[model samples]
Target: MTDTKAQTQAKSADAGHASAPKEHYDIVVAGGGYVGLSLALSIAQASDLKVLVVDPQPSERLRKDERASAIASAATKMLDRLGVWGEIGPASEPIRDMIVTDSKVSDPVRPIFLTFEGETAEGEPFAYMVPNGAMVGALSDAALKAGVDLIECDSVKDFAIEGGMTSVVLESGHSCTAKLLIAADGVRSRLRDLAGIPVVRMDYDQVGIVTTVEHERPHEGRAVEHFLPAGPFAILPLTGNRSSLVWNERTDDAKRMLDMDDFTFSLELERRFGKQLGELKELGPRKGFPLGMTLARRYIDPRFVLIGDAAHGIHPIAGQGLNLGFKDVAVLAEVLVDAARLGQDIGAFDVLERYQRWRRFDTVQMGITCDLLNRLFSNRSDILRHARDFGLGIVDRLPGLKRYFIEEAAGNRGDVPKLLRGDAL
Candidate 1:
């Protein structure tokens, strides 16, 4: 016997319920770190797009991170436009000037090879050394306030592009769908691997020892980078009489130093840190991150894209890792927003390729530059050292070239995106 019309309608509803996702969004970003949250905040603020961010950790947990980054002027501009830089800026320390020194660990005096007035031509500091916790906290809170959905304590387990939308499965077995899927999971991105994206990577066999130190004298907003045979030992000024340290060393040497007693470690730190900051005392805990450069072979897939560390992870030699990620967020957000306005599919290959085209060269160029800098500086060859020092001296003597380098470090060079240029989308 044939079913009644009402019964057929009820069965159809049941089928729909079985196939429909628990939730749907215009974009679902995996890994709600700085890049993911910033992307969500940008898109949510600029348009009515529904955005969701999934991460394995809660916002509070993310804020407990002890790391600090050198936030470039261009990034701060974007953050200000997003309305969260106010919270972050107050907690940050501007780099009023920067000096680069090339010397050996045994060198009694580290002669400054290059000096830069950190402020851009507009009288803004080229960069700020901001605590990671403050930046993450501000971005996370702002993203939430901007109406972006957040899912913590779980992450995107896997995903598949289907019928113009990407279906996502979370580790908790929860499922959702979105027009576009983004992976900001990090350098060792699980989502990137799942998507079959290949990467070009270089392990420097060096580790960056990150920590903070309290100095007897104030840093006066000056940053110092001592290019030693081990690597670049950067003393980035923080608020008060403190400075953040990014010390690079050979893997074995870093292991030994990290295992040293407090007194012994202080001596080791001082040998390179010098007496300019007066006495130095270690602050909080020290973290060692392996140095490397990881660049995804491609930045886009069908309805999928990568941002931040998932797309490229460069050496901290130039302190531009986070800045590169910010560039990604800016370009991608602008591309997607413009496409949405033009009534084009935001996740279409061509539309996504626009972002890839705009960002790919910049990312690769920066990665190679960092790699070369690391190689040139992190070595024991006397000839190479002299050569690099001569180059640095030339850059120092040429004010125009030095200004260009400062602008490059500020991330205001090249084809600037609207968000990065501090303009609204």
Candidate 2:
């Protein structure tokens, strides 16, 4: 694909100027994040659809991110099918084991309540820990190579629908019309709102403190989730001797902690992290994101559709946040491509509804599941804690149940998309 800058410059001026020539695209994706990029690459597989990604952020900036995410097995397959996994796989670390515990930060004994050995007979690990930058870089490379046009340093300012075509106006003063518009602008998606889609939100009033830590001892790819009274604290293994931490806590507490001096924050982290990793040194940047679940009322509106966090945002309790977004990309890509192959309008209501019907149920279920789990485990009620612990122990002992969980975490048990199943769209 040609550089968007050259395309824009060749077209017209950026400021107050004469009417710019309208660029037409088959699919116009808003927000060039992972999900949007993945969707663009998938659609470009046909080499027929003219797709454009509108994002305010530059690729270089996205590739400089230091955060990490958990990539489920199914999601890995999706990337592989998209010809991106091979590029990013070397930087990813497979999750070989997981331990779940219910305890307080001050608890002297944090007994492991449940442990899962995450391995499949297919020799596929359940998940991988991937740096945010690595994944973004790989996806961008693949999207560009596959001929997906990316309008960088500009975003969808607003859009209008006339007939079957949706006209999108970019902040750069560029105008483009497409048969379909995918809103992947993230949790606070402006495109979703512009399309008049409403979301039902269940705020947890908690925040997830995310950062990386270099430990003295090797984690051996073992992950840990400690269900503290406030929320879940997950220590996910990374390559080398580092691990990414998602420490959840009350919103107020998290705010205060984030404001604390480095030494103070380290002391607090030590209390929750324990000495299992020998010694711990906080690395890179630390961030606190408010936790909640938000599900859009509809995934589609006429020629417009929502994907990724624009469609649904759930708690990261189970580390399914990014995986869910990838799942959206996989299914949306398959639906749009299938419709195109059949000579049907990809943005037609009937065509778009297929993706809605296929994904809404699954999205709702995951949202509620995360909500229930957070409520069930994040508390100090002894009776409730004991019951949940007993349940965890039971599940741990039952190999069949453990396998079920592993599959679920691997994202292989849902309405399987061909892309996620390692098949081309």
Candidate 3:
């Protein structure tokens, strides 16, 4: 594809600014992943804010991510408003329904405790499964087109608040200043640490085995989650007859499984995967990621702020991790844009605090909810299992309650940002 006018300008800026003493931008996001790119794009497109994204990974590497993510309805709305959803929609598979089951690994038959026909009041599917690569690619292209500067193969090594702006030092020794510095870096964010923000953390002692599979039969857009003693195993339908797996297992067992022969791994996978979709072949490389919950004690520090995984990292039991990050992008972008429009200092404590106040409680609540659900369901206690199953069954039977859950899962719940609701800034 040909580069856009803004992309050409960004390329020229990269070359021209390489040896410059110091550069300045309205906002500098210290990570070019989904959150950072989306935040940069949203602000740049909505306003004339000069946004810059710095990341250690190159754009080519970012677009090579093999994983997929569940894009909730609200997030999709935001993406649509950003003008990139048209590119992403063709590659996404809408989730038509979902079923939840709690059973042991050795169980001969697993009965569903909860079944949800995935749709919102507006008749949109609650979520869609989208390739991570597609998401990053589209967001990156749109961000660049929207005049967001991107510096790849470099990252924010450190930064300090100087006067009303934050001075950032990159790993390559280049420096820049921004009205606001955002740490959208991953969960283990060095920028967050540099800002001296403390975090509340909990180790799950579990690892999520993520991979894709091609099945003989189509999934019909049905997503499945099986709650085993070790953890939840999810089968999320992808485009065509493929599905993505987020299989959780104890750390030690996960390590063993990763080292197993393909045949052995396939057998074990089948035991959990079942024959519902008929024969399946593993597609692409599989990876295991350690699971944990990490929430920043404070979301802001002067001109510095945290967003996405840098702010909160939760369990995937409810598939809400990415959605939560999208929420952060929506709220922070809205707050900053509003501040800019009001001629207020976007990096000032009062302005940043508004964002912190709006997001902190929601982040904490979701983190705690995911933590509790992970603990409650990732156990072998028969009494607790029965009680939880009964509760799930009751919730399934209550249409009002089910609708509430569907709305929540769709990210259409309380205090939504205008962007998330498909509105312009």
Candidate 4:
């Protein structure tokens, strides 16, 4: 596999003898997005393995954007493990409480409501809100501090596995060999296709309109989720009086909404959001993305594995998408590092199988939950809506059930890795 023309030329440029190979790493990660960068940092910290992260975009460029953001408490622990929570924490907005309501705009009746107060045994928040660029920037810094090689402005041209080693050729005329190769390149991963993995896909017929806004009144670190017939409108707290909005609407309607001027858009937003935050001003241009789910046929191959969105994509209604990727990193890093400690082949099928077993069920369960929620809340049936509201009211009145849900949101409900629990890997 290393004898390919590009690999050979790259090797020759690094060494005097054509027969001798040069520049190798323990693991090569294709795609240096959030997932890949975090995985590289975790692996480098836990083992003596040399890690290489290959990404097409420069690190600096990825740190600026008005894009989709994520929720859930597990992501914070993962960032702490990567050693950047301190830098990121100051910029983040804590979600002190969450209020959920269900009702129609025309109705004057009391809406069925549910509320959760974020709590922790250690007096920390249940979750935080950070921009996409901020998290990636933090990961990039953490990876560099851990001595992981960051190869920016480059992409994997091709890859092959032979003799139990995976070889990759880069567009920068560089070749790297590693025992294991990971694909974290996201939903449209080319490496996943190259590995011949099939994906099961489903389109939600919805588009998420995302933007940041500045309100006249302070949010008091509260997040509000309103379930409308079309979809859910989530207002997540940002620093101070600012907040991030993820409004899921029908695809066709969202396109027209995006085309409207700022004044019209804000008015529509206010109608849905009500006077909770007073006057809302647009903080920047709005963006929208089609919503869908893609699940890879398999998570592992001979010497290759997939992580993050490369392995699975799900509806963002629950806001667990990126947090799920962090869980993937935690599991895979633990499995591989444990194998290395015991003198086991880190890339062996058994080692990779451990990661699959650890992650596959959790990932599938979250995907199914998100899919069901989107379907259940998007419909306008009066009977179904009444039943749903009744269920929410019951859960709201039951403190035990509410606490259980809160614990789950805080990422403390199940078996978790040490790093995910805010411990050293």
Top TM-score model: 3
Please give, for residues 197-308, the per-residue lDDT of candidate 1 as tens digits: 9999999999999999999999999999999998999999999999999999999999999999999999999998989879999996888999898999999998899999
Which is superior by TM-score, 1 or 3? 3
Candidate whose lDDT is highest: 3
Better-scoring candidate (TM-score), 2 or 3: 3
lDDT of 4: 0.83
Q: Write the candidate numbers in order of decreasing TM-score.
A: 3, 2, 1, 4
| lDDT, each prediction | 0.90, 0.87, 0.91, 0.83
Q: Count the backbone clashes (under 3 Å) in each candidate.
A: 0, 0, 0, 0
Question: Roughly what TM-score does model 1 have, to 2 decimal places?
Answer: 0.94
TM-score of candidate 3 against the unseen true structure:
0.96
Error of 1 at 88 (Å): 0.8
Tens digits of lDDT, candidate 3, 1-425: 99986788567556523433337898988888999999999999989888888878887787888889998999999999999999999999999999999999999999999999988955689999998999998898878767777888788878888878888898888898999899999999988887788999899999999999999999999999999999999999999999999999999999999888888999999999999999989995889999999999999888888999999999999999999999999999999999999999999989989888999999899999999999999999999999999999999889999999999999999999999999999
What lDDT is reached at residue 107 by model 1?
A: 86
Instruction: Give the runs in model 3 whose Cα sits over 4 Å from its true position.
Output: 1-22
Which TM-score value belongs to model 4?
Answer: 0.92
Model 2 regions more than 4 Å off: 1-22
Lowest-sum lDDT 10-residue window in model 3: 13-22
